[model samples]
Target chain A: MSQLKYALYTGCTARESTPELLSSTLAVAKKLGIELVLLDEASCCGASHLQDFDEFLAYVLNARNICYAEKHGLTMVTICNTCQINTAMTKHKLDHDAELRARVNEKLAEVGLEYKGTSEVKHFLYALVDDYGLEAISDKVTTPLSKYNIAPFYGCHNIRPSELQNESNGGENPYVPTSLDRLIEALEGNSVDYESKNKCCGFHVDLQAPETSNRLTGTALVDAIDNNADMVVTPCPLCHLNMDVKQHHAAKTMGRDVELPILHMPQMVGLALGCTEAELGLKHHVTKVAL
Target chain B: MSRKETHKKVTVKAFRFNAETDYLPYYKQYELEVGADDLVLDLLNQIKWEHDGSFSYRRSCRHGICGACGIKVNGKPVLACKQNAMELLELFNNELVFEPQSKKRAMKDMIIDKKDFWDKHEAVQPFVVADIEEHPEHETAMSIAQVENILDADYCIQCGSCHYACPALEVNEDYLGPAALTAAYRFTVDPRDEAGMERLELTAQMGSGVWDCVKCFECAQACPKEINPIEKITKLHNLQFEQKVARSNVATRHAEGFVHSIKKHGILDEGHLVAYSERAAVVKHIPEALAMFKKGKIVMPWNMPKSKNLDEIQKLVEISQTNKL
Candidate 1:
């Protein structure tokens, strides 16, 4: 029985595009003795698009997300990077701006909820490093990833917009971050060093410029591959979706077959901790990597 | 005398490259005792004056202004004049590698060829296009809110930090980097500018324009002035959407799909979002879709459960003062 529990906010992508991420996250969390209570009532946190359409609507939606998590009397943990940023950004904005909080609270009241701001919202990656302790996870590693070289891709929302996304605020980094690298080392893997580790995965802008977005993904993949990485891992399922499903497109942009498999943070951890491929739902990954 | 221990002996690997002399770039390691109060610029000056006089880097304002000392500390974009050296050193476990902001554009040690940045900025023609004949008084005639809107953006130092930090540049060289796009936005919002439409037109361009930004917010993080270039870029996106200026782009379509899906289902139906955005182009993803379907990643609409409290989501949007989609 683990004391650490969280209202798991599995963002839309995890529930839809990359269900493996959620399953793998569960498998890994189970091993760590952590309980992830689902925030099933929570809807999408606008995905950054809702902000462009209606900033207030996005705010209300995210505020409602926090409210659902607040109901559990636990900190909220998200698997997706966008979900992490959107909810945290909304919480920050509302907490800082009393008027906005009042307005959002009035809206929340309609749905039998109040914007109490009780729950601390964060990504599961941060939850592991912050609350669960890296030493605990490392100590439980039954199968060390000593033979593989992996590149950690800290997707944008995971470590960006540093003003609201600093380490203290439950983010990795706005500048270059080593949190992913530290996690990789904790798993007994040769964490590849590269400059573009914390850069955007270009998934957010993929629809706008497919070529440019593909190039962004390709460049990151090529960077990792060039650095002798066996595979790439990310805490963001949206990033995994792009790196997995859209890898062929990335190849077209780069004019090379850089087909390195992508792993969700939990899948990597789960694998290192002796979780079976079936248990982690590794088959769901469009790009298969043999460990 | 219990204070924060502020001094430490840290090893810094400063990048050394001379296009005129060296065939390849190399690092010159320096072990020095630096105070917690020392900035990156101070360290550079110390290296030049004491360690190696031949080491060259541009510095004028010594403060954060001029954007002259835009370089990468620990392989991340930052203004040497603005960032605390010891602070960054501590962040990266006391090992700092100082290098030119852009490797392809490096002219000398810590000096990049900024011609691309300037050329892109000039392409936007970042100057007011007001008609003096129609309303000359418009220059000084502006409300406080109007000035405030453009004030933060106007403070941009053009420190190619945003440019170097931008991941979009890796894909497209012609992609108008954040600093230039930021300049476009700063000028366009000015009340005196009559060429707002033209400026947006220039930026609304598909390849080398506003649409290319990957929304990483690196530009926002790298800015020493809190310019929030991503905010300006998204504002450009909103303005484009509001004005219906860039109606043909896939980005606009994607935004529309996102809004429509949220409004209809409360949660984005990923399958439908793609279907709506791509329309005919959705055929391209059929293979990918099939793969996901086999894995049960995509449960058909009937199989996928509806999100709970969607009526509340709709009500929230209905009551909130959201922009018309």
Candidate 2:
């Protein structure tokens, strides 16, 4: 197998909230003979505050991370969707808009940095298929996940077709082959038929208003469960965090009890890659997926 | 229905950029051989690891827990971990494209600022509001169910995907957005919270509060947690109704007009609707009103026609009232 090099930029959530995904993905990549390059000088990707308010501040903070990547002559590979969007969007803006570029450069100059706009923002999943190749990834799968009935949850950011992302595939395309989905299938896991696969999980909304999110999340999960999905699979930590931990909240608000296990793609891949449950971060989860 | 053959070779054309050299953004094409279940996140990782080391993007917990992976997969905001790759491979089929989420400053490729998203969330004082007298040196006895009831407010990952997809936030940045309001609702519904009234008052005071929502379901659709922010806004509106807060005069007027129309005509009377709405317009334009009347736009005034289901409507209202009681 030809070795591939990637500059891995694990966002804060992977570090603090879903570290298991990072550890497991790294482990799996190593087994596949892939070189995982850590961003030595990387800071926060600045995905958290950019969409809320103060676009300029978001630019400044994210630009710092981008400049670091540029200095290393490496592209970014992120594990979180928000970080990917924020970084990709920032790169898009800095590269496309001249006035904005000039302004951001002036700001970067204050911090002893310059924004020339050249690095490519790529998600880890994209890197997996585009670089390592799924066939290559499949060759390394030692164990099949045929026992697990997995239902994939495609959160809003990664697959959304928006003006910012400039996706050729319009939003709401159900046929797109996401890496997590392919991974599950490759492992012989049961990928159930579910509507609203690409729908929002209401994580951000839940923070501000619980009652509203309860109804929506409740409805979505109920639908997924009703469709006979044994477990909910996702690649984003926030989705896993909210679905696993907040599921009780959703069930409580709706006056019922339902337990759905949330797993990161890497954990699932790790399990399929013959990694033990301990190696996959299964123990760290609030709700354990019975592998 | 006929059977469709699934293709293995999926072409992805992703949007590429950085803050260091590209004057104009372009698309980079990669042919990925994927199974029926691969997600886009896996493909991006493959590309970054092998094809290009300079690809810049952000992600964590490739399972949608942190909301850090939000991006435009097709045009909608989605988490990379939650998405399937074959879905895109077939849809665009050798022409899949991706870009960053809109309305934010990009850092390199996909990373944007996240501080403001948290700031907006924090601005709401997102926590349980307890105004009840505290037990001296003791904790209140609450069941797991009770605690669970209000835990939805605690699920916010602050991914900003909802905020990015929020149309109201797109137009009005001052709006608290869905995630923040969901946080507020967490406290409002808490039985242990004694300061619900205070929180409600504060939320009701903002211009972009509950009243600003046009009832667009975008935020709800954008939420990875399935938190229906629009429903939360409606609940806040109900709270306003209970508190008798008239901050949403337009909403109030619309509701009253609706109620009055239903009350009088056994159905909505477009004529009376116009007259009631005149309260907001301040002046009734006789000519425009007449024109509408002539055009049969005023359903109530003309008593144009009753639905064949009038009894059903009345029965439904009665059932609603009974359920409320």
Candidate 3:
């Protein structure tokens, strides 16, 4: 078998906001013997603003990073779901959208960089499920989590329709796979399929209007809590941000404390890496959840 | 100082990547030792140095302030430095599946391209814009309270989590998004910025601007810095009252209907609320209304119940408005 490896693109959030996920993923990657290379000085993927308001600027920014990965002769692996969506979308746009590709190429030329759009952008979840396989995962099982029952919150961005993603594939059902369920099963935990897994976190509404986000999130959370989810796990930082930090406000609006603890998949994975509570920075949560 | 210590061998499943594929991906698992107080960051660092040096991830400050270390720790978004590995051991019984946040591009193990986040941040024109030029000898021009108003907006660390979590940004591809709107609000309340009117106009024009938001509060929640982009946007909406630029939009219509409904009755009147909001371009759908009535979803006069505390609700709004003025 060929030795599998990839170039790592830890998005800015993981670098500055959620270090535990980055560190934990690296730690686990090392133990798994996966050769991962770090992309230094990686530019932003034009996450929301550039892509939404200024596609040309977004293409320039995302293409530059693609150029970086191409120069290193490695594929790109992303940590943030949004970063994945944006980069993949940009790649899709660059490869298929000729006008956009040319414009972005011009912008990249300014920085002495260019993207061929050959390198593939993969989310860590897809890599884990496809490359490592459950058999390989099972071989490394040291501690069993048969007793844990978890409810996975997929959030909207990572698993929604292709139009919702950066890359819109006719073959891909954006709402198809429940990576969270598979992840829970891999960890030897019970995956409780709940109704709120694919629903929007009301994040956009929250940004534009509080009452709507609050009311909507309140309804969704109440259902999740009612479904008996021990903890709400998601792959997007914004999902965690909304589910955890805004929990108090949601509780306020609903007139009830739906204190569901939010966890990033990497932190949960880090726990299985034999890390302690303090090692994962659990104390920093807006709403404390007893692990 | 005695603390309960549980020593257990834990399993770690990590995602593997290659830059060459056009399709599906998978996982790799490993074994490690976990102790009390060990965080996810500590464990990864240990693995990187002791087991494999090729492991790559980004981290800074080791606290939640930097907003750089967002990843999926066992299927949830988190700051790795802020997460305790031991907590996962207890929460999930010591089994973990680690991956990067799903929607963004993966550079290697835990990183994604952030050029977009930074560019989007810069595109918002994040710097404070003031109307009046500074004079060395001039006394303080802005009020402390006005300065304080923009404080929350100023604290944004540009994590991009809000942008990542934003569904509108995912689909519309033109909205200014929470971070940009919040940035706009920062300038709107600057007390020195002459562009408040212009800024508001620009926001109104941007399809993905404040109007596009479905009000999910996801941005506010995802914000590691607790800037509450929602509140900032709300403040901007309040500024609309002062701007007097209300021609007719979804938000304005909703706000007006809500205010008028409450003013007329103690509580919201479904009939009047719908009728008033019908004036909005987005909400004008007679067929949808007919369908609601067909399905018996719309409540009739006697079938509909009013809020029991109507008087109290009316009194609150009246008092707040009087005091607000």
Candidate 4:
């Protein structure tokens, strides 16, 4: 029996683009004695794009996912910032709007499911800090990352448009968030503060305005370098992809020589918890893990 | 207690540049005693009147309504007239740093170019263009609910806060930006407007339109009026999908791909999504594709399995139906 359990939601980017996030998340969870019940029945939270199709349909899709968690009697914990926000947005809307909730439950009834609003959504960062105490995590740290000065990148959906996100996801100040910084401190690492820490990753516009997206992406990494940080860690895999895989594109756009290892939040935590690199699927990173 | 008892001292750093007088921009710091109720514009007024007449910035109604007091106070866009100077100092660690909007070209201290901003706003056709001949009776009354539909976008004061806060605008000058998109949304949702579809087509343009929005919430974060300009843009997308307008943008295809993939597998099929969205241009990404494949970022589409409740999800969300996204 695990001490703490959550219905894990491995968002699209994690499941498809970055499996290391899912693997490292699981590895870290096992070490922390946290049980993550895979929400196998879950569908995509629409990735914030589905609302463009049908807001009602997007709401229903997430309502059904939350209903699945309610069936398991556990909180819905997601590793992706997008998933956390999208799910939290759904919960916030359904919990507030009776007519909307009634309609959503009506659609959900077609699948023999009911969203009684029994479950809450949280990011893994929030879950770790809130439910699983930072002190507890500090106790399990076999490898303190004191040598590295890490920059904590809290991406947009995780913090901004704060009304739509879980209010307690990061911190009150969306402009200058400190939760990720505190998490870094818990792992015995120095957190370098930077302007781009809470800015957009430009991943959303990669297909639309490739060069512009790259510049915005590069700005964050460049800001990290300017802040004298060695490595960057993000709670969002989409941020990781843009910062790591597309870093060359960003550098090319900004005309700067920049190379930095971008770690998924779980991978960094996994390292601190003494999990082997192989166990955390470290081989999949685009940038060579400098550590 | 005297009035001085309530006043607190802090340092004010304002961006100083005259374009003609100064070769380069520089920050000039000054000391001031401010009160809790002092507006940022009041401080600027004091700085001009008492500290330095050389310091210059824009000011109009001083009530945050005219949208003239937009500036970057402590690295975030806020109306100088609306924001409390003391609150700003408290929020930003007891120091005030006033600069022009980050992305916009600076004209002088705390003032940026608004010509292009207004040009994009004009491009959106922000007002209603109803078929007046049909309504000879001149009855263009709308119910509260109809007005409520466009109310959020209606709250826009054209402050350029969202416009300046946007990263898309920073990188892509051609991008229509949130203020203009909110304008487009405002008219598109106007029940009385005949040009709703026309506005949609206008916003759906290739390079300079809605698709370029990085979907970052910075626009929403910067809006002083609490009007989430990004949400308005999202509504515009919803309207486009509902109308089933003929469109061929990458963003439209990307959205369609998400719908198709989710309907098929209960989750996204990344390989197919790229192919579906990029079409023949997918070949252009072969280098990055190979790199991703080497790192196991790109998975074999066939190997990806279906979720057990995929059918249940489809049954609920009706993804198989062409009616919804």
| Best candidate (score: TM-score) | 4
Q: Model 4, residue B276: displacement in angstroms?
A: 1.2
Per-residue C-alpha lDDT of model 1 across residues B1-325, encoded as one tens digit per residue: 1226588887889989999999999999998778868888889998999899999999998878888988888767788888887678757877888999988788889888899889998988788876567645544778998997785888988888888888887678889989988899898998888888888888888788877888788888888888888888878877776766766546666666666666566667899888887878889889989988887789688765456877877777677744543
**Residue A107's lDDT in candidate 2:** 64
Among all windows of ten consecutive residues in candidate 2 chain B, which has the lowest summed lDDT?
B316-325
* Positional deviation of residue B48's Cα in model 3 after best superposition, in angstroms: 3.0
Docking class of 4: medium
Q: What tens-digit string does per-residue lDDT give for candidate 3 at B212-307?
A: 676444575566576768657656655655566544644455455545544443233444554664454335445544443442334454543333
**Stretches of model 1 off by over 4 angstroms after superposition:** A102-113, A167-171, A174-176, A274-276, B1-11, B21-23, B29-33, B51-54, B132-141
lDDT of each: 0.82, 0.62, 0.62, 0.83
Best by DockQ: 4
Q: Among these predicted structures, which one has the highest lDDT?
A: 4
The sequence of per-residue lDDT tens digits that candidate 4 reaches over residues B220-277 is 8899999988888888777877887637666788876777777788888878887888
List the candidate 3 regions with Cα displacement exceeding 4 Å: A1-195, A198-291, B1-8, B20-23, B131-135, B138-142, B280-284, B301-319, B322-325
Candidate 2 wrong stretches, greater than 4 Å: A48-51, A166-179, B1-325
Q: Candidate 1: which pairs clash?
A: none
List TM-scores for all candidates, in order.
0.91, 0.51, 0.51, 0.95
User: What residue runs in model 4 are displaced by over 4 Å at the alpha carbon?
Assistant: A166-168, B1-6, B131-138, B319-325
In candidate 3, what are the lDDT values of residues A144-244, reduced to their tens digit? 55666677776555653344343421122333345667777887877776655766766544433555566656766777788877777777766665676
Q: In model 3, what is the error at residue A192, expressed in angstroms?
A: 4.9
